[model samples]
Target: MEYVLVLYIEQALKKGVVQTMEMGLAEMGRVLRQRVLLIVLVTLLAVGLAGAGSFLVLEPEYEATTTLLVQSKQTEKGIAYNDLLTDQKLVTTYGEIFQSRMIAEAVIERLGLDLTEQELLENVRVRSSSESLLTAVTVTDHDPKQAVTIANAMAAVFMENLGRIMQVDNVSILDTAKLTSDVLEPVRPKPYLNMAVALVLGAMAGAGLALLLAFLNNTVQTEAEAEQLLQLPALGAIPFFEQKGSSGYRVVVRQDPRSAVAEAFRTLRTNIQYDEAGKHVKVLIVTSTLAGEGKSMVLANLAVTMAQAGKRVLLIDGDLRKPTLHHVFHLGGQIGLTEVLCEGVAPEEVILPSAAGPDVIPAGAIPANPSELLGSPKLRGLLSDLRIRYDLVLIDSPPLLPVTDGQVLSTLCDGVLFVVRSGEVARDQLQQAKGLLERVGAQVIGAVLNGKQRKRSEPAYSYYAAPEGDPHD
Candidate 1:
């Protein structure tokens, strides 16, 4: 029984390790996919530079080789095994002598070359195998004819000096270095080979750079990232969309109700309704960590979506300092929330109606003390009165970290729907903003992850889309 239990534990541990590895690979693949364009551009730039250097900057070098045979003096009874062994041993000595400085200088003088002994020796090579008695002399130069001439001269000088230095006449030239019109290809500055190597190295470097950039990025990009950082439930994920020739806020739920963005808003509405089993979120504040995160646009569309579901919804622009809902709904912003809060104007008179099914109350004017006005007792009373009149009241407030207006409004509202735009707000900023709301004892119902990048494999609203010729489309 003990062994069985131990075996079971081992199997479970292996399974857990496998699962962790799979998850890590999946996350890496997602990061690579997100930065594929940057990697491609870097790779192409490297390849271009390599091609230029290979073709335009570097000089080509040509090589020519001559072969020589080293043999022992043959006896009348033919060659013996010991003679062949002696010749093999002599091959090594002959190879070194062929690359000596004396041979290099002699070859340079014989060929009338404009090069020093060391420089000519640097371009010459000698190779011989242990089992063979043949030595090859190779010389490289910028000009093909110079390379051939140097190679043949080096072999001749080595043979003439060998008889005088070692008193041996066993070396003979087997093949002379000959230049031909058909065989003038340079050995160095191989453009195709260099480009291939550069291609591989550049791709590796680009991939590494992309991974480093992904690691350094601290922004919240996906719904999972937002939920993991803020510890908040994701009520809905709205994919990003853009319409040409359209400006200001986009009420996609009202204009193109059959589109994917509209479907996302409707999904958000359904999730909000089902968030709490027996409770309903009546007065909600929609806010983000920073400005331009699309909180106002999200609130406008959410209010319209709720109203489309047979609920009386009121959309209020709660940002007193930088009001934009007036511009969004194309209404005059001279008299709305500020007048009702500071000037004690009646809320019913300033309330405007829109064709998008939601009652709009734009921010009246820029206020010097937005935090004080939002935190007033009269403002609480106004919300309480408005909450009773409408089934759902959605307030678009300013960013939380920039000012205290959103936190103040959170205390007066029934719930807060935090908006997080993909790759816009950092993780620390969202954490700090959520901490501020929590400090005020706000009821954060859930979060709405906006501007999420949709995957290519994931079809957007195609199942609910009407046919091309259909009137609904």
Candidate 2:
């Protein structure tokens, strides 16, 4: 049993870590997909602009090649120049004689060129063919005429310098320098290649950055968030149920079963069980850090679910400033929590049946001092009275911040269940909400994640699996 427990705990912990990383990747994929069209368009535009610019804006330079034959001065040893460098030893003297400043300057002076020795040298190239006694001399320039003139001059000077310095006719120009009849231009700053590579790199960088941001965002973004960021059990999820009622856009949980909205509430009930809470969970308060988080809807649906389980459940719209139970139940706000509190009306008298099966009490008339109303001894006495008559009471109160209504009412319940919508409830909001609940000393029973999607990596609960027959193998 101990081993099993340890293994379970380890699995749960690993799942939490993996879930966080996967969520980050999932968010990255979503972002990439959303901007895929833009990425492609940008890539095409970049490559197109680069290719066009390379072809039109850049002028093509011409190349004039002159070939020279390298023969060995070591005919005495019957060793050929071809047996140098890659063969046995490099003819260091010949190589230096060709690349020297003396030969380069002599060529420049004889040609009456305006280029510096270094600049002129850049245009001249000496190349040796593989395992051969032949060398090729090449000069490239923007002007075709200058290219050919410079090539021929360089060859004459190199040969003269070799004869004068080394006293040998080892280097001979095989082909005199000449113009290419098929005069062509060069391709550099390859815009198409550069732009294509840049665009691709940019896309990869963007995706990688998005993934990093997602991973660093430790706040809960969805049901996957609850399991990953907090490593906590998700009590449930309740969706926004919309239907045409006597009032505009209210939930008909009984009439519209199997809807995505309905499934949310049922899922919430299942998650509640995941917390290992006592089966007799009652007197729950639903609240968030800020207003407009669908806390009331969650409470209403939770109450309905409890009622469906044959429990006498009462839903109280504790948000005295802004009520919703009366509107959802179509009670016209005639009699509700405000009326019962102010006039001392009985709970049974103000109780209204909901289309979803919960008995509800609306906020009634807006209270000038909601904080005082929630803190009053009468509210506590009323809760004490209602607790005996009903199996569960779900109080839908205002947000935790901007008022003390929720914190005050939470004091009258067993625990407060926070409702956070995916991408809607930010990390700071949850932290502040938790801080407030802690300040008020309210028991924060696990959270109910709202509008969360299941992840591919997360294992789905098998609570509602279909009945099946055994198959013979």
Best by lDDT: 1
**Model 2 agreement with the true structure over 398-453: per-residue lDDT tens digits:** 88777878888888788778888665655655776777777878777777776565
lDDT of 2 at 110: 90
Q: Give the TM-score of candidate 2.
A: 0.65
Off by over 4 Å in 1: 1-23, 39-57, 75-86, 179-182, 193-209, 243-248, 277-279, 462-473
Error of 2 at 189 (Å): 6.2
RMSD of 2: 9.1
Q: Identify the runs in model 2 with alpha carbons over 4 angstroms from their true place.
A: 1-203, 222-232, 237-256, 271-278, 326-331, 343-349, 426-432, 456-473
lDDT of each: 0.85, 0.69
How many pairs of residues collide in each model?
A: 0, 2
